[model samples]
Target chain A: MNLKSPREQEYIQQLSIDCVIFGYEDEQLKVLIPKLDFTGDFWALPAGFIQQEEDIDEAARRILAERTGLADIYLEQFRVFGTAKRSNKTFMERLVALNPTKLDDWGLDLNTLGWLTRRFVSIGYYALVDIHKVNLQKGNIDASIQWYPIRELPSLIMDHEEMIHIALDTLRLNLDQKLIAYNLLPETFTIKEVQELYEAIYERPFARNNFQKKILDQQVLERLEKKFTGAANKAPYVYRWKRY
Target chain B: MNLKSPREQEYIQQLSIDCVIFGYEDEQLKVLIPKLDFTGDFWALPAGFIQQEEDIDEAARRILAERTGLADIYLEQFRVFGTAKRSNKTFMERLVALNPTKLDDWGLDLNTLGWLTRRFVSIGYYALVDIHKVNLQKGNIDASIQWYPIRELPSLIMDHEEMIHIALDTLRLNLDQKLIAYNLLPETFTIKEVQELYEAIYERPFARNNFQKKILDQQVLERLEKKFTGAANKAPYVYRWKRY
Candidate 1:
């Protein structure tokens, strides 16, 4: 189905919201990306336009839910991309060329095409979700939805790579003050897992002793029962976020 | 002159930029606001619409320079306010009521009036400037431009009050990491003065010794020759930002 129909043109123009959904598993930081079905090689962050009646935050939440099948996740507005030439004219041209019949089938005329392909100021939002719990949905526009490791991100469409960098920088800056990492973990997990997440984000290994001391000093975690493993001498205790 | 005219209708639609200009003086945190000439009781942050050819950051910088008469100041985009109801209906009504003759005088018809008062998705940028250095300009729309202490801010038009709150929260969050306080200080200042600025921002007092140690440890400051006071045994050492 055509996402941008003539009916949608009545909504706010030239504003869009893109989600940089971050997930962690297998000791790697990952980002959720949607492969464009029409372009075959192009992948983009899950994004959508805001309706006239909806709040921008609500639009972000809707996009997140539509792609990941999750709602009320930890979402933040990090930055705005409002450069005059943010939309790649070459990419749009290629997209148009590749899907001329499809565009006609969807009732998109030259006017609608021009409107759809114009430069947009997108508000970038980042979401943190537990990789294990999310029920990912392959939306109509995407050929497939999958998480790619942050260290080896694929070439993304239209300044999305820069958006990801800004999101990571914001996450790193807020890591301590806000309990953001907790969203990426299970309800209960070992302190070692938490340390690994931090190390992956910062791209540096923390000394075991010092990392434990620093996390404990934050006083935002509660020690829980030990996880038993057959080969372990003394299994490390698990932790749950302490209610403030 | 009507800020919104047929000429301005050619600019980018649905997007605007508002600046929360912060300043420090008299041991207080203050924000720059302009009193609307049309609506006597209404005040707003210095703001403008994004032009078709200008980058959003450049739009922000232009607005800042236009209002404060200072260029190349420390500015950062903090958040975007995109609720559908961000522009208060009551305030717009009052403004229209007070400026009917002016609107007619400037050739603003019903369509232009409706367009001017419609909801906008504003990108919020915050700036820190030396209060002493700003050459405040009372613009055509504003009756007067003045700095109001953050704690005792007058009731502002639209969501500007909330914007100020968010700006302060963002500033406090980045205070330590970015050495943002230096932007609010003069080129040279005493340690005690620095402490007072922090105290004002945080709304609390810091122990003299601990504050001194903390500021000194940042290594961003350079101690200079003491300013002599006739009655003092030893004057506090003046410090300036170290040249990078």
Candidate 2:
């Protein structure tokens, strides 16, 4: 026999999503995060609450498209963060500052308000999109959006900076396996440029001959002719992804 | 300034823990789960509601100990699953079958009984422990505990099965990095044994010479002069992981 009513059950559950967007360009690895319109222009990763009818993955895709104007990009679930203090005082303060009217406008009760502000376990997904493909737009909660080179990111809300660091580490470990698919580069790039991308991520200088030999041995890249660049004595040969 | 009373916050805020317990032995990877006693043997991953005044990780660790007698094992956050449907229909049917007295025992309101089921966004963490180390026990709500190898599993409650499969795939991708630390092997074993383990996971017959070369190149293992069993004459060299 059914003991409880459905309405009470419905009121207790909640769902949300967080996205880690990676972009490779300008010899720097960048992550796309929401720039909060609070406290002299703060920033955080783009995230949102899920609707009753929407799927989590669909929510991620929708949010990515809404904020970046890109569709069909390579996005994958990474890890979930569900700490008790997911939105601690520091985080909610920022949220409140971002939009003063949000709480009252929603007519949220103290309990409902706490549930919204309390421990949230968010599924983290990473999307690798070519930097050129993104035409970034502000989120509903933000007045502006931008891609900051990961190395030079400003202080982020909550533990978002830590989240980005973890995402980058994940990329480094799975680069060989995951590199085959996602389009984080131009249609074609030089060996030097590719190496530079790795360098930016690895944050170290790699031996040139050894690096080239290692990648070439993987048989994952195809070479293309290089056009003269007038300034250089010889144009480096360009290469595009051969297999994913 | 904080707007809500602590009592009001308590009504809204809560914590919980879930475990994906993985075991490997006899050439198969398995997950430990339980059958709900109240729900006519409906299945679920072994989990528990977290108590107040406990850290999130502590809650997971405590649950692991109370359920399985396991302590000090490698546990990593995988992903959280929190869809509204996660706790709908099937869950309550199972719960009603398992706990006829839950509503009365918990002092839950008849009118708001279903709503008390509320939304739970679980933080999923996977623990890799030596199966031998677990002191598995059936809980008050569970009829019995069981281990199902990845290849053979019955219909799971909610998305628990999907969660296990995802964990398994992640484990495979992480095998090389985790070979030494994850207790995927005995303290000492022959190269042939290690090869067999990998072959079992990859589900392919790797070329012996190539496999040996790759293993040697990683410098993760150290060869030993000792050999075991009644066939030492034909046996390969014994090897143990070099401490990381």
Candidate 3:
């Protein structure tokens, strides 16, 4: 990836945006992590810097669209990562040790990153996209972007891991609203399906009864007719999110 | 009230911190606002800029300590307010129109705020302070710091009002945890007290039955023996947050 052109433009180098776009498929919660290094080792969330004219959220949306070629995704600003120690120095050291190519347009080494060495306080945004839609090749999306299960993420650069964890917690906190907002579930679904989705999201199992009771407590669901089954008493009720 | 000194330091000029410190008194939720104008009218949240060496969170804590003279308060990083149109220009216009003195040490007019006119995206932090504790007169707290009920807030500067609203929403989302975290209530309180606290927080009334059910669902509270003396069933059960 060329880092030279961003400086050529009027990008806000000291502030950046990192997006953790989460998708669910095959009962697994996956996050889109781009391999920023040619060695296929260094990974980071889809990130970009803000331009002088665009808003921070606009920059995040632009970066997401650039990577996935989609829009109107479920996105939320979770938190900002601005520790005193959060600078390019650590990443700078990593790049130097790994010896990645294309340092800059100039012959400057990693240590001489100049103003690039200044601390960048990144604004973290997390998006919940329908996997089938964003992963579709129909859009002007990059074919090289990869998706990895959130739990199985490779070692990420910077504080992205911490960002993901906080994003996950925020997701869990607003799971009901997000599910409703994005139509994450089918129009109607059984308790088992919802439980499976929750399990995929939380990365843990839930007791059937406990799951049922808690889900109902949210009042986001309205019970529909039960699914008729050959086995008596085994038919579970189908429910739809009361999106009112 | 003075903005001249911050520029003299190695402050992160383009990024700032705005705090929405919520305190409860007499069953009313109040927010701290500092009047920034000599006109004694222009109000904004207690805010400051991050230093080059301090962490963002550290900057917020330091600002809180500087204003309240207290530490270890319940603080949270909710969201960052970074829109394209955010700048000191509007505030500058207001200052110029109002004829506020101390325009600048350099006699620069509002039109030439220089880099200060560049969009300053603020990280919004919120704190849940015990009104009595922070309002105490022991620390290096500003004597003129004022607390206004959320409902009766004055006209705010920039996007501080929007910041405060979102902070309150975040507060409601984590009310149970925040309450328990801060020991916001006495060691033991009645269901009515809890409901009142919720009412004060939510700034709305809930049917007694509905509020009780909602509070119980959180499961943060444990019921204690009924206070004897009143007519039998009229006496309510005492409750305490189950810290465990």
Candidate 4:
């Protein structure tokens, strides 16, 4: 898409939105990232410009849906990144070099190029989604879309790494409030699975007995039937989130 | 204060920042608001435009300092308000009617006025300050600056009421983490004072024994000398925040 089109000029120029979509799968935390179409080595969080007529939250939800193909998920605004030099000139120059022909075909003038390369203050939003439910699609500006382990994320473009850091901090803070975790877990999950998820996100091992007691104390989980492994002497009980 | 001047055009036009400075005094939660200079009945959170060369957080701090005449306070970015028609036509007409001569003196043409009255996306930042510490000052664009009890706030302009609501929610969420409250309290305080502060902010009574036990369990407070009441049989102990 030509971001510098005359029609696009009606939108706010110096503001944008970026979403950090967190998903849990295979006993690990993951984040969705898009490979920029032009820069082969550059990855970015699913992000887009805010339309002139939409609310900021609406813009974030629209971007998240467009990229992840999921709606009605748990989404939140975490932080705003507005450093004066966030759009680093070196990164812009590299991007331009990688897509000179594409830029020329877009009919973008020097003024438009300068405008595109200028600093932007982007609002960061984070979404918690069930990994198996996502229908990811590569957009026009992205060569490919994939989920990477949160702890081992590839080098991302601009300040997305910092954005993810802030998002994770926000998630951690909200963890104690019992507002998350359900979004990352399956409808039916073993207590061990729940403990592992917390350990993965918190990057610490919790004592099994203590963790179970603490989580059960919240009174938001419903104990369900035991999962039988045939060979096991005693099957462990599973639980599901009780709707409040 | 002529926003239409050539020098003022160097700043970003579409994005602005507003600060909700919360103060606690006389056992009441208060917020500082400025009476708009032009519109008689209009009150607003201290707000200003973002300079192109500065970071958004820096802009917020500058605005906070400019109005409160204090620095090194606790400030946080809470939310971004970006509705399309945030600048209501009625408010604009009222402002223009109140300041027709001032507008003309600033050489503001109709196009400039229209641009000024167009949609804007503002980042909301909240500051927590000790009421005794702030050197409040009224700016050129404000008829007066005053602190009103949070619950008894006057009608505010634009979406400031919503912003204040979000800020209070943020503060409440952080209260449990024990990361705030110190900003609103004095350096030394009695347990009763601390409980009263919490009660005032939450607008609910907390059981004395349970509140004391919970706060002491955090292990961040150091017991000081007893605070004597003239007719007290046993004086209550004072506590100060321990520097970690």
Best by DockQ: 1
Cα displacement (Å) at residue B168, model 2: 1.3
lDDT of each: 0.85, 0.68, 0.73, 0.83
The candidate, 2 or 3, that scores higher on DockQ is 3
Candidate 1 chain A weakest lDDT stretch, 10 residues: A1-10
**CAPRI-style class, candidate 1:** medium
* lDDT by residue for model 3 (B140-170), tens: 2122568899899989877889999999888
Query: Ranking under lDDT, best-scoring first?
Result: 1, 4, 3, 2
Q: Which residue ranges in model 3 land beyond 4 Å of their true spot?
A: A1-4, A104-113, A135-143, A177-192, A206-244, B104-113, B136-143, B177-191, B206-244
> Which interface RMSD values do the candidates have, in the order shown?
0.9, 4.2, 1.3, 1.0
TM-score of 2: 0.76
| lDDT for position A64 in model 3 | 81
Candidate 1 structure quality by residue, lDDT tens digits, A1-244: 1254546555677778889999998999999998888854888899888888889999899889988888879999999999988764667678778877766777766566566566778899999999988999987778888999998898888889999999999999999888778999999988899999999988899999999999999988999855455775576687999976
Clash count for candidate 4 is 0
Q: What DockQ does candidate 2 score? A: 0.23
For residues B115-216, could you state the per-residue lDDT of candidate 2 as single tens digits?
334455566777877777788887766677888777788677777778887766776788787563336566777777778777766667888889889898
Task: Give TM-scores for every candidate, taking all chains together and pairing residue i with residue i.
Answer: 0.93, 0.76, 0.82, 0.90
For candidate 3, the per-residue lDDT at A171 reads 87
- Residue B128 of model 4, lDDT score: 93
